[model samples]
Each structure stands twice: as structure tokens, then as C-alpha cells.
Target: MTICTRFLNQSRLWKWSVLTVAVVGFPWGVGTSQAGFIGGEGTDNPSRQLKALFAEYWDDELRAGPLEATFLGDHRYDDRLADLSDAAHEARVKRDRDHRHALEKIAPETLSADERIDREVLRFTLDDRIEGERFRDRLIPITQQDGIHLQFAQSVNFHPSATVGDLENYVRRLHAFPRVVDQTIALMRQGMAEKRMPPRITMAKVVPQLRDLAPKNPEESPLWGIVAKLKDWSEADRDHATVAVRQAIADKVSPAYAKLAAFVETDYLPACRESVGLWDSPEGDVHYAFRARSFTTTTLSPEQIHEVGLTEMARIREAMEAIRKKVGFTGDLKAFFQKLKDDPKLKNQSEAEILGRYRAIFEAIDAKLPDLFGHLPRTDYGIRPIEAYRAKAAAAGYYYPAPEDGSRPGYFYVNTSDPTSRTTYTMQALAYHEGVPGHHLQFSLAMEVPGRPAFRKFGYVPAFSEGWGLYSEGLPREVGLYTDPYAEFGQLEYSAWRAGRLVVDTGLHQKRWSRDQAIAYLEENTAVPRIEIVSEVDRYIAWPGQALAYKIGELKIREIRAQAERRLGTKFDIRAFHDRLLSLGSVPLSVLERFMEQNQQTEAEPQR
Candidate 1:
């Protein structure tokens, strides 16, 4: 999860444990030498077969998604952008068919329980991906929230420009940017022909963002920041690289962005639907239902979810009201919310001060983690602000997983873009959710899980991952981390804020509420400032059904813990339950429920 787009999940155990990143892994490259499991290549062992299949598929898929590879620190495809044409989509279909056919070759009943879990994780992930392909996510290639530009911008930053060779490879991608942009334009127009375009209002916001992205000169571009970071290059090598980069940005990059901007303003905008909800489009009901099920990992309908959201909003508001009176605030919840918003102590902190606050929260968390969790990741993480370029469109904070090789630490990106408008009281809660016991720990542990197929290890399930992060926000109170009522209030406020998402997100997409109505609903229900309310409402509008994951997942996780506490009684080891839950990385919530239920039956450490 990047600062610009988040809501991904991670795993750890019941009182003790999970990154619920929603990645799909193919089993083509698994090897017997990995930490645990039988290695006989030709042996009929189902686990080995699953591992081998995933390993091989992972390798192929990595090559296929170059930007994904770059983010993962694999540089083999650094010189290229994804080919977003129909041909590429067709090729993906062919690959999916081959992978599915091969997967059908493995017998799940013959596999161990753990392998069976892995098999199902892989199975469902493929099902989701294949169904998504049919929906043609590529059909409408751009959105205000997610699109090629942000992907390119974010991926560009992660490129390791350690050498002139690296610089040249990156320049090659910059040179190829026009073709990708052109392909996206083609897809957008085709989507329009198919009566599928992102809402006009969303596109209106996107056009300006895209227009602002590419500067006329490469030297002025953020794309050159990587080149600027290369300090040790020989003068001749540096000169060669800089010249090539300048030329690429001037001749290819600027023109590509120009072409894209022109297309969006001239062609795409006129064709974009005036309606915001998916219901206005072809097969909109079915599409929104698929998205709802996909993100929540539950078959619950929008109406059901809307009802659930209302219930949750009421529950969280009661917690918030308790805090309001405890804080000695005079008047009603809304008045307290206004005071919380205007309280000078909680706002206007310098970016450094704000960041330092979060870092301190993490250090406090580190000291208490042992008391709270039985296990921890070997890889460490750090806190930072979102890069200036993306901070405007991005959420207030998000987690970036550590590199698999541990070359770099995981990051909790605080959006200091609008520092004055941001709240400091939420830093501790945000830190718990975005740093340490939240995303970084969960993601690292997921990757490190022994004998997990590549997909289960690195892939994502939103309900699992996002739920864990949301669960984590409340976890710090157990460690006495939210020592003050104000801090505790921040936790409850954020919880209600997410709960409000269900109402707002569902209201926007399924109930056919207008943007203004959604914003007003959030303002009435949650304590976030006006700025965040706007973005949160827009985020829900841009990406349907995603916001539901945090609360839905959190409730399920909380329910699991409650079940364990009820059944295990004095035997309920918080650490053990947490560890067992996390041992299965990136699982669907239903799967996690089954697994945790099975764990409750045993007094001993549950085996993976």
C-alpha cells in the first residue's frame, strides 16, 4: 500500500498475531530448498507441487508486470512499462488459462491442511483475478484515485538508479512512457465506446492532476530525482546519463503526457458519464456487487452492508460520546468534534514535529510488543511522510512494506501535505495502524511464513489485510499506549470515521447518494477535518466497496478474538492466538475464521 492508494491488509496472531496485502501468487517457481517442506521435484507431494507451481508462476508474472517487479526490487524489467493494449489483455487471458489448467492438475484433498489453505488462497485469488479481467479493469484505464500516472510516479521513485546502467534503463522506460499513455488513451476511448468510463466528476479532477504531472523540461521533472540521487558516478558516465535523461523527458516524456492530457480533456471528458455511481453504467449492478464481494471477501450485498454500516456507525458513536464527556468537553458530540478540530494543541505542528511524534509512538510500541505479541518480524521498519508530489491526492497516512530482501525498511508515510489541516492526536493511532504492529510487521511476517506458496506469502486479501490494520489501531489501548483520554478519543474517532465509510461508500455507489450528501453524512458522523472528509468521500466514490474492508474485517477479527476468549478462557494465550492467526498469511476472512475456529479446539500451539 502506497500513500497515494491504500486500504491493503497484513496478518500476525489472536491476542499475539498478520500484512493483509492482496497479492495473487502463481506456483510456477516454488523450490524444495525453501525454509520448510519436502523438495522432491518429481514427487507427487501436493504441497511441493503447489510450491513448485507458485514459484514458476511468480517468476513469469514478475516478468509480465515490470512496474510490480520494480516495486518488489526486481530490476530485470526496469526498462519497460506494461503494454496496456488488448493484445496484452489477450496474452494475460492465455496465461490465466494455462495457470488455471495447471492448477486443476493438483488435487486439493490430497494436500495437508496448511497446503489446503494455501491451495484455496491461490484458488480464490485466481478466481478474483480472472473475473476482474473479464470486467476489464483495463477497460477504463484511468481513475482519479488509481491509474497509470500514479503507478508510474510511485514505481519511478523505487527504481535503483545506482549506476549509469540503471539510469539508462529508467530512461528507456521514460522513452516508452508515450506508448503506454497512448495505449491508455486508446483503452479509455474504447471503454467509452463500450459505455464504460469513470464518472465525469472524477475525470475532472484527474485531468488537472495529469496536466500538472509532466513538466516541459526533464530537469524540472520529479522523474529526474533518481538521476539527481546518483552521486558517485564518473563525470563522463554522469554526463552521458543526464544527457540521455534530458532527451528522453523532453522528446518522449513531455510529449506523452501532453498527448494524454489532450486526450483526457478533449476526448475522454466529453464521453465520460455524468453519473458517479456504477449503477449508471452497463451491468453496473452486477459490477458493483462483484466489487463489493471482492473487497470485503464476503457475499453480503450492498443493502446488507449499508445496514451493517448504520449499525457500526451507531456503535462507534457511543464510544466516541463516552470519550467526549470524559474529556470534560461542554456540550454535544458535534460541539466536542468542533473543539477537537479547532483545538490549537492538536493542530499546526511542523512536519518534523508531527513525524517525530509518530516515530516516538513506534518506539513505545516496540518496547510493549513483547508483552502484546509472542512473535515479531526479523525485518525492521521506519516512519516518514508521503512524498510531496503525491501527498495531495493520497490519504493522511499509509504503509509501505519493507523490501523482501530487507535492503530497505518498510515505511509509514504520513501525509504532511496539509500539515495545518492534519491532526496530531491521531498520530499514535495511525502509527499503530500504519507502522510496527500494523502493516510493516504483518507484511514481513506474511512473507516470512514457512512453506507458504508464493501467492499466500506475497499476495493480498483486503478483508484480512485492511482488517488487521484497523484492528491494530485499537490494539495499542491494550498495551496502555493510549494513556490519555484525548488519544483514546482519537482512536475511537478514527474507528467511527472508517465506520462512516460503509454508509458513505455504500450511499455513494449503491444507494445513489450524491457527493455532497456523502460528504455531509461523514461530517455529521465522524470527527475528521473538512479536508479529509472531501478526500475520503472522493476516495470512496473513486474506488467502490474498498472502504468497507477495514470495518468489516476489524469486526470479524474482533469476533474471532471474542470467540477465542470465550472458548479458551484462562487457556487463551493472546500471543498464541495472534501467532496462529498470522501463521496463515493473506487469507480471506472466511478462511481465517475457519482456521481460528479450529485453533480454539486445541490447548497446544496450533500447527500450520
Candidate 2:
């Protein structure tokens, strides 16, 4: 990894602006400048202590979530859901402020370079949280894609499996659903007051999802089957548990959902702003620009990102045209895209079959891992279907990192709502993005690496984390994974998708583009279906600056790789290079470059 001289200082604030994976939260790790730490500056001891302190604060917060605790392999909170009221959120903010003040005693002059970076990260995150509390982000909480509704669906589907206790916890969570829903609405209202509401187009989809999740008949609900799946439990116990869960669902969860549904239908829908970009919202433009810098870990403006996206799109379009020719399509590229979309053979019929296909892809990808990585995660991984309630709006695939303690495997959820939407041509890239060389391998590796602070293991660096995932997509072809033309097209399609994100995300957030304008940009530029593009565009509008991470990270990683290859000459080993990159877990791109440079020097030294 390369280190940059640009020092992050106390003046900067880290913003939580990425909207792409809202339901999927990011890991907040604290790192300080110190020797013997992953991607550290090899100096500054007290900063290291502070880094440890940050973990305590973060882990304590996670411990409060019964489901999160279980998901993190910390089983103590398995039967509870943390209170989600406004007061609860306020307390959380105060705690963070307290932690921030406590850390302020340590001076930057006393710290090492890496410690300074960690301090900056800590200060930025804390300051951002404080600002967010002051400004309130919860009001604009609903999105067509990620949010509490989707997360609830996931918890009901994924975390409740296995033991009778697990089943019981699921029921408790169901009972707690009312508070959760109410809290979400409260947050949304808070955001609304701050002019931070989710885009009208995005919030439009929230009502249907609420309706889907808030089924009148509990028997027809997604939770009903998840509970029904419990094994070795008695029929009477099951019956009793079912009644309790249903009561919670109907009386509590459903009412809140109904209220929110009404809000969306009546209040929010009418009040919904027509603006497509975050810039149009209250303090939105500035907020989005800040968010862009935070997520890309670069100071590039939206205009710069927009231009970058256009440049990349043009480059990929040329490659796509080559594929079109190779496939013997005499028609224009647009016609070829239509042909691919209309093909019946390109899709699966059922969710199970879609998931099974992903599972097989995982196995195949696993077999080839030895060629690229010297180290691999021992934790098991699963390819599962998204819960029925949320699948309709979920991404084609998403990875849930393995629990911190390793009890639960990392999960890659394949959305099979409309199998045709998850086309066969796109499967390889999806597999790459979510499975090996993508989320699972990179995340699991980061969590287990020895000598790294616990925070680094779980800390999310979007530029580094998601960047690595996007970068991994192209790495498979480097090892000959995209042999088929269609698979190659899939690779291009995925690349096109990320590139398109840059355009539409910027267009929606900074350029005052309409929702339709953003949607049209994606449709014109990529092979993604219209609905997916529309859903994604709305996400960018709600979340701002998040869409920039993929291409930004990919471009940086590729640049570093090219530089390394040029400098190392014939001695460069692709597998070792990748190992060095991933083994440090997720760090800023600058830190990554420095690490890569050190590896070059180490490799260059005389063999003793």
C-alpha cells in the first residue's frame, strides 16, 4: 500500500453519505499511529491506546443489538432488539460525544503519522456523528433500497435459522418490530425536518415494501415460514411461538407499518421534493460533495467524478462494441443489448435455482483461489436467497460479512425476485463482486489477519473495501476466469454498471439532474434493466456520493497495480501482489500504496 503525504487533520469531518448499502452498515474501526499495527506508521504508542479505546466504544454499541450481537458471533444479545426511539438515538450520540472529548486530551504533535491518520479518522467520524445528531439524518431514512424494512427481512430470514433459542430470539425480534418501525419513521421525520428526506422517487417504493412486510395474515408472511423452519421443536411449542410472533407482528409491527404506509401514501408522498440530487435538498449539495470525498477517499468534486464516469464509459463502450462484433451481431450496439435482454435462456426460473447457481459459482471460484491467494479465510460461506419480502427491491447480490467471532458464516444473498432481471450473462461478475475476489474473501480475510487491531479487522474503508471488491471483478480475467464471450460481456457489463454509477450518481446529486435524467443516463450507458437502474438512481439521489466509490476505488487500485508491475518488472508476482493488498485488510488507498511500495523494496533486497 502507498501512503500519501496529505495529512488528515482535525478540521475535516467524515460524512455518512453513502446510500448504496444503507441496510448493510459499515464497520467503524479506530486505528492509531503505532508500530505492529496493520497499515500503521510504525510509531506512536498512546495513539494506539486510543485506537483500542475506540474499539471498546464501537463494540459496546454493537453489543446492544441482540441481532447484531448474534450476527457478530457475540451471542449475549441474541434475544433482544435495542430500543430505537429518538431518545435512544440521542443517548447514543451523547456517548459518542463523550468518547470524542475523552480522546481530545491526546495531542497530534505527540502522535506518529499513522496515529495522526487514526486520530483524524476518529475526529472526523465523531464530529460527523455530532453534526448528524444536530442536523438529524433519521428523517430522510426511507429509501427504495436499503433501510430498516430490508434489514428486518434479512434478520428474519438469515439470523433466525438453526437452534430453538435462535427461533425464540427471532420471535422476540418480531415482537420488538413495532419499536423498530416507529424508530425508523421517527428518523425519517427527523430527516424531513432537516430537509434531508429521501428523494420522492425513492420514498415512493417504501410503501409497497412496508405493505409486503406488513401482511394482514401472519401465515402468509415471510416471518411465518422462517419460524416454521425450526427443527426438533414441538408442534405445541411451535404453535405457542407462532401465536406470540403473530401477535407482535399484527398488533405492534403491523400498526407501525400501517402508520408509515399511510405517511408515505399521504404525508411524505405529497411533501416529497421533486429534486433528483442531494444538492437540491436542504444543505444537500454541500453535504453530497463532502460525502463524495469521504467515500472515494479523494477530494474530487462531483463534476470531476461525472467527467471521470463519462471517460470510463466511453472506454468501456469501445470494448463492449468489440464484444458485439465478436458475437456476430451485425446490428448496432443498442439492438444487441435488446437481444440480450429479450433472450429467454439468460434467466433462472426460481430463487432456489438462482442461489444454487451462485453456490456453484462459489465452488468453481474457490477451486481457482490457490492461483491468486496464498492465504484464504477458513470461515464457511453461504449463498442464500434474499428474504421474499425484501428481494423485490434488493440488489441482485449482496454480501454480509461473517460474524466477528466466526459462529456465523459470511452470507452472499442472491436476489431472485425476477430471475430474468438477474441474467446469466451478469452472473459471473456478480459472483466475483460478492464471492471470491470480492466481498467474502476480502472482508473475511481482513477480519482474521493477525496483529491488526480489532478495529482494522472490522473497520470499513469504502475506497479500500468496496474498491477492492470492484477491483476484484477484473482480476478474475487476469487469471483467465472470463473465458466465454458472454462471461467477458458480463465483465464489461459490470464495469459499465459501476462507470454508469459515477455518471448518474453525480448527475443526481450535484448536477440537479432529474430522476428521469439519471435513469436515462444508466439506460443509455449500460445493459442493466430499466427497473434496476431506476431503483439505483433513486438510491443515489437519497444517499449521495456513495456511487462514486466503485469506480474511484477500481481506478486507483488498477493504477497502483500498473505502477507496481512497471517498477517490479519480471519479478512481479500477481498472487503475491494481491496477497499484500488484501492481507492488510481495508485501509485508505494512500496507505495501500505505501504498503505496496514497501513490498517492492522487500522483494528487491538480496536473498540471504
Candidate 3:
């Protein structure tokens, strides 16, 4: 039964009823003891059998294409590419299923704490995949928001550089673009028959992007941007690269664009569904609700989540209003929002200037981290512009995890495609959220946590991961940072953005709100530009229930932190609390609460 069902039925159950439940115990489970399980040496060392498994996984994953490797910081696979074929998808599913099957045979009681957590993450992930596959998601193909169109733009924007090798890699990958686009088209076609077509409005946006990138003269294409930067290369090498890239564009890339555009504009557009949310699909509502529970790692119902979103929206608006009043704006909050949107000073001169601004924000915030965070990420992080192809449809910013072996640094990709849309007031919180205190810090720290399984260290529960990022944003103020009022307003803006996400995400999915309605809701409530709101609404439409995670996760973390502070009082060391939180990496709220309770007990005990 669902937790809600259990809650409703609790009144009828005998108060003292007892039932056996499976629980991890002793050598079979990793508990407080750090002991290694299954014929292992030290507690930190996995059993030799598990070590072999780890090595095998590393090798297999490293062999994934160059883009995947580069994203993961594996330089070895830089020349290769992701296989988007049906066969590749099948292989991926089989691999996950096989791993889950193999893991089920190993008794959980025989694993250490780290190993136990790793095992659970893998099982949960595999279970989700198996369940997800049963739904036959292919019927829902081609959201205007995806496809290789945006990816090509992204590469041109970010990959062009001074180094010959860097330029060559960009050109090499551009040459291979046609095959990748074909793969994407095949996947979309499979989705079309399944009734999974993207909304017509989104597919309309795809055509313009194709036109912009598919230049009649190959020299004018974004690939030519790399050619422009090849000054240092030897004439022969440069000629070779230029020829290879031009041919790829003319023969492979351009034709691929023509095919996809024709398919989207002519074929798929007619069959696209009119419904706004997945709730319209077969058992769509049930799937979305399940996803909500999984993402938040809680038992919140759609109604409850909707209500919480409403509450947060009101609270954040009031805060923004106060900022407006402090700044002595004679007009109302809405007026101020409009003024900020139109102000010419808000726009950056160019994309490079935007990166420099973000770098400054990172440096400014780094000076303040020591005041609040007891633990910090060891991996270095750098800022990069989002590739042009994806930039138009991508989030304002995102963080990529650093390579495990430390060869490549973690990257924070900022989308500066629309300079007018990027505002300085928001940069402080954006950097913190995507870089330092946000994703990279939490993710990189999790990767470095000793005595944890590789999976647990790298695994994500969206509620846990995104919740931490949202939670990290407000933490700076609590630690006596964000002294600048505008910066604090930026934080409030960030909070408002997440709060808006909850309302809009649920509003669209459960309430069947229209795309325009969702976009209008964001504009009325926040200072974000109309274009961004449109794109964001489309994103939520494409990927239902994901945006809800930010606010829901943040609220839970904040709730727990307040509970911990109140209970421990003077004994609560902020640093120690942070340590406990980070030490466990990403865990469900239930596990986090348990950890807090354990810490409280430790605090209550007298020191030796």
C-alpha cells in the first residue's frame, strides 16, 4: 500500500501490532562498523571480489564514447561518440538488468556500509529502469526541446579554442554530427509510433534552429568558427581538418538536418499530442505521482506538493518585495521587475564577458565558504560556455561532474546564448548553485567520501542532489555571508525561482495547465525574461515532475537543519552538522533524519 493509504488506515490498525520486516543486520549489512565484507582486508578496502568488480566497471565505462568520457573526465574516449542506435539502448538496459540480477544473489548482510549503500542505489536504479521500460515510453517521442539541433550550437559556442588539438576535436566531432542526428531521428520515429510526439509548438521551434545551423555555404556554418581559430596549426593539418569538417557538414550534417526538419515539420507535427502532461498517457498520472515520490524521496501527494509550492511562492514574493522597498523603488514589485528586465545595463557585452563575471562570482563566494562550510570539494572547477546547439533550449546553467581519476576538472557550463537574458543580480546565486556550494561541491565531495562504494559516491537521488544545491544557496546567509543586499536579493530571486518551479511543474502536470499559462505564471511571479520562461515551461512539459524536486528537497533539508539546531542548541556545531551531511553523500530524507538523530545522541553524550 502507498504511505497515504497506510496513514488513512492507521486508525483501524491495532496500536501494538507487530509484523516482521526485512532489516539489514551484522556482516550482511554495513552499519556503524566500518568492517569490510566478503573476504576483504581492511574495513575501507572492499572484498577482493568487489575490487575486481570495481576495476571491471571502470574499464567498461571508460570505453564509452569520447563525449561521455570527456564529460566523465576520461580523455581516452575523446575520439569516439555515443551510440544512439536501438541496439545500444538495448545493450544499456541488458547491462543494468544483468548487474541487478548479479547483485541480488549477494546477500546484503555480507556488505560493508559503503557497499550496502552502493548495492541499494544500483538495485533502485535498475528497478526504476525495468519499471520505466514496462511503460514503453517510446510512444512519446520528439519534444521540440531535445534533438541534435541544440547540441551542435552548443559545440560551436564552447568547443572552439586556441589549441590545435582542441580545434581538431571540435571539427572531428562536427564531422560525425550527421550520423548522430540520424540516430536521434530514428529514436524519435520509434517514439512517434508509440504516440510520444513532442508538442507541436516545441517542434515548430526546431525548424528555425535547423535553418540557422544548416548554412548553404559550409564556411558560414558554426563548424567554420573552429576553422577561424586554427591560426597556429601547420598548413597541412589545418587544410586536412578544414576539408574533413566541410565534407562532413555538406554530406552528413546538412542532409541529416533536412531529413529531421522534414520529419518534424511534415510527419511528426500532425501526430503530436495536445495534452500538456504525462498524466494523459496510459497510467500517466500514476507514473507522475510515482516519479514525484521518487524524486522528493517523500510521501507527498500532488495536492500537498501543490499547496507547499503555493506557500513558498507567497513567502518568496514577500521577501522580494522587501528588497524592492529597501532599494527605494517608488513602484510596486512587479514594476521593479519590469524595470530590471528592460534596463540596458543588465545585458553582457558578449559570452566571454559573461564567463568572466561568473568566474568573479565564484572567487567572491569562495572567500566566504570557510565561514559556513566545514568541508569543501577537493576537485578544481572551471567555467565554460554551453555549446550553441543546446544553449537555446538548455537551462541557464548546469554543472558537470569531474573525472573520477582527477585528470579533468568539474565544469560549470553557463548559457550565455541570449546576453540580454543574463542578468548580474542572478549570477551570485547561480554560481553558488551550479559551482561551489551547489552541485560541483556536493557532487565532487560525494565522489571523494572515503569508505563509500563507487555507486553511492556517484549516485543521485534528485531530491537528495538537487535538494542539497537548493539548500546550499540559503546556507551562506546563515553563515554570516551575503552582506551585500543586492546579493541577498539575488539569493531571494534564486529561492523564488525554485519555489516557482514547484508550482509550475505541478501546475502543468497535475492541474493540466497550458504551456502559455505556465510561462505567464513565471513572468508574473519572478523577474526572469519572457523568452526564458517560455523555454523553461517547455522543458517542464518535456520532462514532467523534475522541476518540483528543487523546492521540495530544499524545504526538507532546511526543515531538518532547523530541527537539528533546535535540539542540540549550543552543542550544535555547524561545521560538524555539515560534515555529517556531506559525509554520507546523497541519501534519502529518511536516512538523513536518522543521521541527524544519531548526531544529536552523540552530542548529548559526555566527552571522554
Candidate 4:
């Protein structure tokens, strides 16, 4: 699942909130002595010192980012929203710097191997965030894909409203909307003065979303969903909560959205830059270089990545040509792509058909999961249509991991916004990537990994997570799932799409390729629908260096697996290999490679 810059920024805070429930111990026999050290002085014991520091940082993070806390199922701060003000941004930067300083002072040599890994992960996270401060990301928070407005509109889905107090907390957050909106506008205004605005075209997309979110009638507001679901409460209590929620929506939330829309259309949109690439902005080259390194968790320059993309695309094209010939398709590979896109029979008949097929696909995939994975997540997942308001700007699909408390199941949000545009063959590959054996499986297992700090459990490294997702699409083929040539072609199409991202993203950013040029390249190369290709290009424009993570990550993962297979000969177990990878949680590519090298001789025993 691709993440926007706003979501990425918030994820740093979200990653640090500790789960409220006790996670089941990992079956691999990793000792949990360090996990028990939540706080206290541990100057003499570096392991204890590092764990205590992690605990402290976690607490600070939750306090600083209450919304993120709520998302993590830690309800202590459910009544509050995050501080989006400049002071909050400054404080966060200082806190990250301080944490890094504290981390560096700890003696890594004195800690256990696990604690050392934690120290390095935390250090890397801190340095990345600190380095990002110079780019002034906080100023340009609004984007076509994500922003404060869109997050608030979807609050009812993620925010708990099971009880009266939860309902009241939801209402309080509604009341708090205006303040956050104003804070966002202030930041955007500052962005304008500093010349750090988003592209005018992307900002144009935000205007309609804000207008759609801001309704004159309170009952019509998106936040009204919570009030509508208060059936368990006493009638009088429910009535009170309903009234309060409606009033908050009418008086606070709607106006706030309307105000934001006005500001964007009248003030900010006009000031937005015409150029799309990061290279066009001040210090953009340096910023793009940093993002490329940070997102891929590698030091490879954009030129090297672009060439890797070109090579991979060529290989994938050959594979696609073989598939086209296998299917007895006429004309060139591009013609085959066009036929795939233009075929009405390839499209879903209705949204229900689209969702129902995904459910069936996952059910079949779940039964076969044990053939490849020894350890599976206890947390379950479900499929849902992407909410209409933001679906146009969103990706094909994305996974939202269940809160560690298991208050809700993880979700794979499919974009059924235009059902006919949803092709039939792509369903299996998309399902595998976004749902089981992809994000839901990887993320749920990560959250359950025992004795890890909150950051390690919940933090996302795009290369690892997205790489795993891309790798998952192809994993099913080995299990003989994609039997139909069209289905296998679908998988290849998605692979080509990700491979295309490596080229298109760098092309737009580093090579200074025009947005149209990137779009044309993707159109000619991949079988992805035209609408999605356009959306993806704009996404790359809005979030630089992120698109490079998928193929780069997949290639690294595949490389490691190939090495393992070669070393272990017939003894190599795919299930154990998968378990070990998931057990590490989401980490840097470098960290993952180092772990694999050190543990090459010591394999994780397969779970019975």
C-alpha cells in the first residue's frame, strides 16, 4: 500500500504508541527479559537503559500525538486531536533530536543483540525525521491524496465509538476540528511565504474534497456515521449524544471544512507551483536525494535505481510477451495491454461482484497459506470499498492494519468507486497484495511480534512493507493459484506497473521528466487502466521517491530468498524463511540484510 507524505509524517508518531494488550510471546523462543523493562534507571545496564529510553519515547509520542494514539487503540487520548500548530512541529523536531542524542549516549556494545538492533532502528528513525526537518515538510501538509480534512472525514471508521464516553470523545474531536483546520491553514500560509507549496493541479483536487466534506446539514456530515451507530446506548443518552454531535458538526466541523476549502481555492491554490518535480523546489535536488535514500533505505542514487528499473522492465516485458503468445494474442505487447483494458468482459459487473470475488479469492488463498507460511497472524482482516470522498485520489487499494488491541479487524479497502473500471484478472493479484500474504498478514504479524518496542512493531519501512507486498503477488503463482493465463498476466501487469514506478518516479523527479511524459511511459508499458495510470503519476508527483520502494524492495527480498535457497539446498523451508522475515517486523533493508547474513546458519524452526 502506498502512503502519502501526510500519512507518512503521522506514522512516525503512530509507530511509537505501545499496544494496550499483552501480545502473545513469539514461538521462536526469543527471550523477553528486556521487554519487561518499561521504565526506571538503568545506567549500569545498557540494555535496560535502552529499553527504558524506548518506553519514555513511546509515552512522549502518545502524548504528543493523541489522534495517532487513538488509531493504535490506546484510548487514553481519544478526546483530543493532534496539535498541528508550528509550536508542535518545533517541539517534535526537538524531541526527535533529544531522543537521538540519548540513544547515541547508550553503549551499543553492552546491549544484547536484540537491544542493539532496537537501538540502531530507533537511531535510524530519529535521524531520518531530523534530517527531514530542513525540508519543511510540516509546512506543506495538504496534498491531493491526504490532508487533515480527509483524515477528519474518515474519523468515524478508525475512532472508537462503542460506548457513551467513546461517543462523547468522538463528538469532542468534531468540536476540535476547527482548531486543527486553522492550524493547517496557518502552515499552508507559511508554506506560501516560504515557497514550499504543492503543485497547483494537486491542490485543485483538494478543493472538491473539502467542499464534498463540508455539508450545510449536520446529518449529512461524514461524522454523523458515529451518531447513527449509537444504538446500544440508552435512548436519552443516545439522543443527547446525537444532538451534541450534530451541533458540533454544524457549528464547528462543517465551517472548518468550508473555511479550509475557501483558503485553498482563494489563497493557496493560486500560489502553488506549476512544476511537478521536487527538483523544481528550493534545495529540491538534495531533498529528493534524501527521500530516495530514506524511502528505499539504501544509498543508491536515483540514476542507479532508474537503470535498475529499466533492466527489470525489459525482463518483465519479455515475460509479458511470452504470456501474450501463450494466450495467442494478436499484435504487439502494447496492443495486448490495450485489449486487456478495453475488454468489457474483463471488468466486474457490479461493486458487489467486485467485493464478493475478492472475499472468495482470499478464502481460497487462506486455506493454502500454510503451504508457504508457518506462522500466521491471529488478527483477522476484511474487505471494504474505499470511501467515495477520497477514492478518486487513492491508489488501487491499501491496507489499514488492525489496532494492536484488536478493536477492529484490518481492512483491505478496494476502490469499487467505478466497478466497471475494476478489471477481473487483476482481482487476484490485488487481493494477494493488499490483503492476505501481503499487507494484512505482514502488518498483523509485525504488531504481534513479542518483546519488541512500539516503533519496531508498528513503524513502516516502505521498501520492506511494499517490497513484501509486491513479492506476495508473485508468491501465489508458485502455489499454483494463478492458473489462468489472464490471471498470471494480471500479476505480471502489476509487476510491470511497480517496475514502471521505478522508472516513472525517478524520471519525473531526477531526470526532470514531465508529468505527461511519465504518464505516457506508464501507459505504453503497463496494462494498468488509464485512470489509475493518471492517478499514480499524480501520486508520484505529490510524494517523491516513494514509488521507487516497491520494485527495489521486491528485488532485495527475492535476492535474499534466492541466496537462502542456494545455501540450504533442499533443506531450505519457505515457511520458516517467511516466518523469520516477518518476525523481524518492518525494518530498513540494510538491517534486514545484516540480520539475514548473521543468521544464515541459524534457521528459525518452523511452527508446528
Clashes of each: 42, 22, 20, 0
Write the candidate numbers in order of decreasing lDDT: 4, 1, 2, 3
- lDDT of residue 60 for candidate 4: 69
- Candidate 3 C-alpha error for residue 44, in Å: 18
Structural RMSD, model 3? 9.3
Worst 10 residues of 3 by lDDT: 1-10
Write model 1 residue lDDT over 382-465, tens digit each, in one string. 777776765676788887776566667777788888688888787777888878688776778888776565556666577887
Would you estimate the TM-scores of all the predictions?
A: 0.92, 0.86, 0.81, 0.94
| Candidate 2 residue-wise lDDT, 1-608, digit = tens | 11100011111112211101112233334323222232233235676556655565555455444444444455445567766676776677766776677567668888775566556656666765565453345565557655556555555544645556766777777777777767766666665666666656667777898887777887666666666575557878777766777777778666767777887788777777776667767677677777787678787988899999999999999999999999899999888888877787876777777877777777888888889888888867877776666656556777777665555677776777877566787888888887777877787787776544454565566677778878877778867778789878878988988999888888877787777787777777777777677666665665577668888999998988898888878988888888888886666666677777777788877789
Candidate lDDT (C-alpha), each: 0.74, 0.68, 0.66, 0.81
Better model by lDDT, 2 or 4? 4
Q: Report the lDDT tens digits of candidate 4 across residue range 1-608.
A: 44222343432442232233223332222243333333323445776677667766775676676666665566777888889877787787877887787788888888888888888888888888887778887788778876678767766776776678788788888888898888989889888899987888777888988988999998887778887677887889988988898899999999999999999999889999998898988898899998899889999999999999999999999999999999999899989999999999899988899889999999989999999999899998888888888888888887877877676788888888888898999889888998889988888898887788766787778888889999999999888899889999999989999989889988988899998999899999988898889888998898788888899999999999988898788888899899988888878899998888667656534546
lDDT measured at residue 202 in model 2 versus the true structure, 0 to 100: 69
Name the runs in model 3 displaced over 4 angstroms. Answer: 1-66, 75-80, 138-180, 216-238, 330-332, 342-353, 405-408, 450-457
RMSD of each: 4.7, 6.5, 9.3, 3.8
TM-score for predicted model 4 compared with the true structure: 0.94
Cα lDDT of candidate 1 equals 0.74
Give me the displacement of residue 441 in model 1, in angstroms: 1.0
